[model samples]
Target: MNVILPTVITAGLFDSLNPCAISVALLFIALLFTLKKDRPFILKIGFFYIISVYLIYYLIGLGLLKAFSLFGATHFITKIAAIVTIIFGLLNIKEYYFPHAPIKLRMTHDARFKISEWAYKASIPATVVMGILVGIFEFPCSGSVYFAIVSLLASKVTYLTGALYLLLYNIMFVLPLVLIFVFATNRVVTEKMINWQERQGRKMHLILAGLMISLGTIMLLLYF
Candidate 1:
């Protein structure tokens, strides 16, 4: 999990370049404003929100790592996972360009509130839970990358190394968002970028979604 964290973070940052990540972040800010009009705390709240979202995403990745491991590299399950992943990837591509056929992501909160409160100081459990949530966000993209990375590392790397990879992957995926947050913190430019993202947002989503499905299909085919 330790090493996989980095991989997942970097991968996540890569995926973040996709328009979907931008849209999600934008939507979150919009929602925040709707709830509390122009509150000064928004930027900070949004910052934590990004952290929380990424944390959740990273954690979800761990489960994926385990599932792929159980299937291994040379088994029926691996073949099937590969097939399904490829299919999902292709489907994502189709969904990307078609405005009418958007990919539907089902998100679940598996974090335990009580335990999180108890573990708040060091935030060990909280961080793990956050990563789990982030990983589940994987439905729309990275099927190709996911398959390839997992398959390649599953048999060879130690669990900690894998975790590092995951952490890095997610960090990269969210790097843009991190940057956006930084830019937004600026009083003058914040509104402009947000407005730009809001207006031309769909392009990002479509493109990123396309990348995920296309690459996922490739990885699936190669592995199979």
Candidate 2:
């Protein structure tokens, strides 16, 4: 079977742009600076957080793919997923226009509060726990894209291939965080990074919407 690396890469890129994760990471970076100018501590906190998020996503993807493949191929369900994806895309696009729209892809207030509390502690274990919790919190917002990717994987490849794709997807998902942390700690474009996010946050939503719409349309066409 042909490996759908492109799909995995694109999905990972889109999923990684989720505001919840990025916002929290940015806050953590800021907290790190406020707490101390300890570069090593910053690196350790960021590393653990990123790795924990990747591991949680990998486990979820692996288990879900295995469970999904057990049912064998389900073209009908895939078609439904495509439709749902398109709806999610539209909702995302709507959010660009109505930023306060009832439909938003974001973490719950409780989750946000918990993360903030954990981030302030600036401990490796706490950061790791925060990462795991954040991953779970953000899943509802970003899971559709991952689900779509996994559905495609289950339909087109074997379980092992699906697992490999999940691994690749998660690595790419955390790449931006890794880069952002490195830059912030090095004092390279730290302020610029935050500013850019402020300016491009809405635009990111549009881009994700377009990506989902395109991917869903193609899936619909392919499956039908």
> Top model by TM-score, which number?
2
Q: Candidate 1 — what's its lDDT?
A: 0.54
Clashes of 1: 66
lDDT of each candidate versus the true structure: 0.54, 0.83
What is the TM-score of each predicted model, taking all chains together? 0.63, 0.94
Task: Quote the positional error of residue 90 for candidate 1 in Å.
Answer: 3.0
Candidate 2 C-alpha lDDT tens digits along 113-214: 988898888888899899999888888766778888888888888899889989999999999899888888855466677777888878777887888888
Q: Evaluated with lDDT, which candidate comes out highest?
A: 2
Error of 1 at 174 (Å): 2.0
Clashes of each: 66, 0
What digit string (tens of lDDT, one per residue) describes model 1 on residues 17-134?
6544555455444544454535455556555656765776666666667766775553444445456655654554564456466354322233233323332322334434433444
Predict model 2's lDDT versus the native.
Answer: 0.83
